[model samples]
Target: MAHTIREKNKLLARVKRIKGQLDAVERALEAEAECEKVMHLLVSARAAMTGLTAEVVEDHVRTHLVDTELFPDALREDGVEELLAVIRTYMK
Candidate 1:
C-alpha cells in the first residue's frame, strides 16, 4: 500500500513501541516477575500485535480490494466475492 511519509513514520513508531513492549515482556519473564504481571504484559503485547495486523489489513483492502473509479457494475459481484475471499484468508 502506498503511504504518505507521515503515515509510514506513524506505523514505524507503533512497531517500535510494540517491540519495546515485547522486550519488556521478555525481561519480565527473565526476572521472574509476578505471574499476573507477566500475563498482563503478554495480553498487552497481543493487543498491539492485533492492532498492527488490522492496520496492515485495512491498508491492503484499501489498495486492492475494490477500485474506487472505473469499477464495472457487472463485475461488482465478482469483486465482492474476491474481497470476501481475501478477508477470510487474512482472518485465518
Candidate 2:
C-alpha cells in the first residue's frame, strides 16, 4: 500500500524508536541488569512492534482493499472479503 510522506515518516519514527529500545535491551543484557527490568523492556518492545504491524496492516487494507470514499458501494464487498481473508491468514 502506498503511504503519504507524513504517514511514512510517522511509521518510520515508530520503527526507529522500537529499534532503539531493542538496542537498549541488548545493552541491558550485556550489563547484567535485573532480569525483571530486561523482561519489561522486552515486553514493551514487542508491544511497539505489534502496534506498528497493526498500523501498517490497517493502512494496507484501507488503500488496497476498502475504498473509504465509496462506503456502501457494491464493489466494496469484494474489498472487504479480500481484507478479511488477509487478516485471517495473518492471524494464523
Candidate 3:
C-alpha cells in the first residue's frame, strides 16, 4: 500500500496501456479483423497483466514482509535479501 502511492503514476500508465489493448481487441472484433490480429492483442494484454501482477506482488513483499535494518545470521545471513531473491524467481 505504501509503495502504491509512490509508484502510482507508473502503475496507472501500465493500466492505461492495458485499457488501450482491450479497446483494440474490441475494435478488432467489431470490425471482424483477422483472428491472428485479435489473438496478438489478447496475448499482449495477457503479458502486460502478468507483468503488473508480478510487480505489485514484489512491492507488497518488500513493503509488508521485509525489514531492512537487521538480519539474524541464524535466520540466514541477509535473510531479507535472500527472501526477495526467492520471491523474484518465484513470481517470474
Q: lDDT for model 2, on a 0 to 1 scale?
A: 0.76
Candidate 2 per-residue C-alpha lDDT over 19-44 given as tens digits, one digit per residue, 9 for 90 to 100: 99999999999999999989999999
- Badly placed stretches (over 4 Å) of model 3 are 66-92
Q: In candidate 3, what are the lDDT values of residues 1-92, reduced to their tens digit?
A: 46778999999999999999999999999999999999999998998988898788767766655454464223334775787678768655
Would you estimate the TM-scores of all the predictions?
0.66, 0.67, 0.73
TM-score of 3: 0.73
The per-residue C-alpha lDDT of model 3 at residue 81 equals 73
Point out where model 2 deviates above 4 Å. Answer: 4-6, 66-92
Best by TM-score: 3
lDDT of 1 by residue, 1-75 (tens): 354343898889988999999999999999999999999998998888877776676566555555546563434
TM-score of candidate 2 relative to the true fold? 0.67
User: Residue 13 lDDT in model 2?
Assistant: 89
Ranking by lDDT: 3, 2, 1
